[model samples]
Target: MSAPFVLLHPFAPFPLARRTRWLWLGVAALALLLIAAAGQWSARREASFQADSIHRAIEVHALALRGAAAKYSYLPFTVAQHPDVLAALAHPFDPAVLQRANHYIEEVNRRAGSDALYLIAPQGTTLVASNWNTPRSYVGQSYANRPYFSDALAGRNGQFYGVGQTTGEPGLFLSAPVRQGAEVVGVVTVKVSLQPIQEAWGFVRDPILLTDAHGIVFLGSVLPWLYQSRRAVAGSDLDWVLSHQQYGAHHSFALLPWKMDPAPDLPGFRVQTTIDGKPRQFLAVDEALPELGWTLTVMADYASVTRARERTWMLGLLCAGLLLLGGLYWQLRERRFAEQRDARRELEVRVRERTAELDEAHAFRKAMEDSLVVGMRARDLDGHIIYVNPALCAMTGYRADELLGRLPPYPYWHPDDVEQHWHNNDATMSGQAALSGFESRVRHRDGHDVLTMVYTARLIDAQGQHSGWMSTVVDITEQKRSALRQRQHEEQLQHAQRLASLGEMASTLAHELNQPLAALSNFASAAKAFAEQGRQELLVSSLDETAAQAQRAAEIVRRIRGFVRQRTAGQEDCVVGALVANVLALLQGEMRQQQARAVVRVPADLPKVRGDRVLLEQVLLNLVLNSLQAMQATPLERRVVEIDATVADGRLHIQVADHGPGIPAALAEQVFAPFFTTKPDGLGLGLNICRTIVESHRGRFTFADRVGGGTVFTLELEVSG
Candidate 1:
């Protein structure tokens, strides 16, 4: 036989307590059922209490309606007994009797506060009315077939509600007969306004209604409900209601909205519906007005009453649930507190150990920081200095006391850097700046500018909030001065190297000047010989040649003078082809003397390069002359120098290629080094200066061996559009 299976659930109070969950659930179900039964009992009791209240209210309002009607109900009978009313009927055509009766009824209607009081002649014609003086007078109208009129003619007092044939207003028509000894001579009717009673119902805060026998609501507190049928009328009832004009001729005759459930066995007279968009349960009750053949209804809302009981029951249930939960929570909370206390004790021990390690680490860090040469400073979000290490004070020439809690621009900041300092402060505080390195100047202790390179990052506290920015700064003032001095020394050396190149070109320049001078001298001799022969044409030709040679010599002098002129850093757009042509012209005589073939190849439309025109010209000249000197070891027939300019790599590339032995691979890296040269009398600063000049223009100067047994030096300069 199989052993009984037992379940053990982790959430159970005990290992065997899983089955108790269902028992608890069963109890909850029973409790809900009891609560529901209690709610139903409470609802029934409330409904009964509400029904009785509605009934009492209906009876109370019924009396108010009667009192409103009684205000003018006796006026018609009293008018019937008047002599003027009888006299008006006796001599119906006499204006005097009509006037007197109309005035008398007007006084009665005014006192009764009724709509109108009028007399009907025996011929069914309205002879006079209280409103005879007004335009809507009923003096000539007929109500011959009216029940009230017929009943009065038959010698009985009658009451009917109908729309006036003359005036369109609806009211209660009370009629009484005038007697000529036992004969029914005429009828007197009174139209007592129902508006006052309707207004009274409005003050009671309950829905009240007065409906006719046909279930048509003739008077009601709500204007929309007035003259509406309480139920759907059909057949003769609808026709009679219409034909009799029980309601006004303009009434819709539609059924009012009852929205009732037809289910049997529903208790109480409560109706739950929205009235004018307000959801409410109204206790509806109707009472009979026996004399008027009308029903009076009164409605009272019981929503507040029901809600109060529901609120009380719900509050009790809530308090009970809370008390139970509080007990359970107290039990579980103590266990949790024990576990938490153990955890906290363990955490406290671990924290103590970790804190000791952290303290040791912090001590080590403090020692390291004290020994550091770089300065450490921190600023809060508002740009106020919060911390400054000893190194920072030394770097800024300020004491810790002076710098702490100070705001920028700090006194130690260089005067020229104050604006930049403020800008950096704002950018840092606003989180618009990145963590990177920047160079700034601060005042030194000796009253001089100290340059510092700072690396910074935003400071975050233990809570991971942006507390401020921490910056590490290194004083680079001496380094910067040394670099400046080195640059000046290099500039002087470059100048001296350029002068040496000029010095080397002295022999070539002298030979170039000798040709033009010799030509001018020969032309002068020719002019003198022609002058002796009296040949004017020959002498003029000689003089023209002499002038041409003189002009040629002057042009060479001007070009060389301008090329050798020294200038500070300056740049302009130089057309590559034109610049190449100018260099060639300056070295024209030298190339011819060297017996070297110089070829210039450049795109006619090559774009311009931006650099100092003289510097670039010097660079080109130096490369070409170096190529010529290199070719001295080769045969004169193999010597060739090529100057080529082209656009390449979004830059202006000008190459000087020579068919000379290329540089050895091992020494190629050192080709651009200052004072490095293979020539016995050459200063190696030429290539270095060329590279520096190109770099200063944001370009490059490099050399490589050509595939065709030659060395090519290339200058790549930025192209300016």
Candidate 2:
């Protein structure tokens, strides 16, 4: 009935047939052993071939990297020899020379396709940069701490790769010292981006990685693997990287979870790692780049070698089975046919089941997309909308059908931002859109404006080819409204604090006005008496004094009004001396009441600062008031408040010093904290409010203990040109 039974029954009647059966069994077992050996040999040969191929690929990758760096190796030297750069370095403070140098560097950088080019002074301050016109310009950044700068200062060419401290972008920096005769005058540096290399590597099938000597991946085909260390990095290496900020301080330098073992029959190593949540094996080949002290690695998948080995083993097993079982082939043909039919039926059933599963998965994904609160949209490479989730339609008050197949300048684009939208769309199509997302305004159907943040990602098709862009948009209108409300609340609090300060000084204000008003009254009465006696000269003198007193009283009132008035903040050029005088004038009565003397030493030639005049005055007044309060317990002779102002290094510095009990070291930091104070009656908001106002003007407020058992508070502000 079966192949095996018929073959054995024929031999059952003869002892010799039985012996032949045993011999055949032995031969079959021997054949299996030979087949396994042949399969092992094939697998080993394939592994060796793959390893050689990987080694070759790694060598090519190393060359490409070296070539990229070589292209810019001479740029820094050329720039250093240029006349403009030399002139800029010679007269680093000359604006005209700096401008010319900056323009020249910008042109050269643009033409050379470099990220940045700049000249550094001997002290390591950036003199001019190609991006000097941008907001994050490196015109005045200090690089004395960088190893490259130090190397160049030592009269040697320097090459290093690190994240830019100013731009926060990773790049290769090449520096050359500018020579004046035999002495190095300054350093010229060129920055080049290596992102193009990484992008090109993504097109290859194998994963390629470029690692620094410290084993940190600087560039890789796998984007997530970039900036990660191949192995555990600690001790001196970690310190060096952190101190130099080689990969940026933001990177944690986490180790990749990789297990490596020497290949049993290959020239390279075998690496086991997880990629996309699936375990994978790779044959790894590494090539050293001595020029840059880097390593180029290629990871070739081992699945192909495994499949080849399986095919070899299958072919061998088929031949052995044919030779050993040839007698039973005819008897087993019908049974084999039956097995094939059943296998086909089972495959069909699996296909149907898989189809059903795919349908369910599709439904699940659709439901998930529809349930998302964040709007989803996708567009093809041609910028034609291909898909829109229900959330997107609801957000724009448009039907799905209306949004689908739309192009640039769509109906939902804000009327005022149609051109911007088109430009953004073009950038997306060209693969230049910012990955961090951008904020934009969208128009609703009911004529309302909606603020949104849109993040875009590449859409990859089943074949792993980039097809288009997928965008996730979130409505940030409510968040923006909340932020605005918070700002308004803070402004109100600041205004209230100003009012409270005025309230506290009410008695001093009354006393201050009393003296001027009394003097005016006395002068007026004298003038009247002299007029009645026909003393013309005396009457004229008295009348002049009366007017002077009245003006003084009016000035005090005006200062108080300006300080108390609430209005929109304004920015203007304010003289530092004038600000100090106004603050002292406002606190004159308080100083007199406390039996304290005010010493003003402001320079007449100080440059004006750019900020809100009234806000700056409030800051000074608060400091003066605090100083006066601190001196309340000091001896009357030592109860003096000194106010001094100076201009240096393009900044204005003002100091208020008082000979009083100094703040305790423990309380010094707490002084600026809100609602923290030493005075029992104080609300503790004076220093905090003063600091806030100063910082709002792009200035700093700091305090330190004076040498003579007192406190010195300093305010630094940028001087207006």
Consecutive 10-residue window with the lowest summed lDDT within model 1: 1-10
Task: Encode model 2's per-residue lDDT on 1-721: one tens digit a residue.
Answer: 5989988986777997678689878988898898888888888888888988887887777778888889999999999989999999888889999999999999999999889998899998999999999999999999887888989999999889999999899999999999999999999899988888887898998788889998998888978788888887899888888888787765478887789899875666888888788898999888888889888889899888887789889999999878757746754775488777868988899999999999999999999999999999999988889999988888899998888898877899999998889888888788888999988899999889999999999999999999999999999999999999988886776777778789878999998899989999899999989999999999999999998998999999998888888864589989888888888888888888999988889878788899998888888888888888888889999998899998778788999999989999888769889988777777778888889888988889999999987899999999884
Per-residue lDDT tens digits of candidate 1, residues 1-721? Answer: 2333234334456644566566667766776666666666676676667667777777677777677667676777788888898888888889888899889989988877778889998878999898998888888988886778888898988889877767787778888888989898999888877766776677777677778898888777777777678677888887766666665565457777666543123333566656687776666766889988888877767675577568656865776578668867986887699678768878899999999999999999988887788999899987788888888887867898888898877888778778898877777677776666778888886697778987888899999998999989899889988999998886677677678777878899999899999999999999999999999999999999999999999998998877766654467888888778888888777778788988888988777787788888888888888988888887889888998888877788889999888999999889988889998888888898888878888888889898878799988888874
- Candidate 1's displacement at residue 108, Å, is 99
Tell me, by TM-score, which candidate is best: 2
- Runs of candidate 1 exceeding 4 Å displacement: 1-12, 15-363, 513-569, 633-639, 648-651, 659-676, 688-710, 716-718
Candidate 2 lDDT trough over 10 residues, lowest sum: 326-335
lDDT of each: 0.80, 0.88
lDDT, candidate 1, equals: 0.80
Q: Provide the TM-score for each candidate, comma-separated.
A: 0.47, 0.51
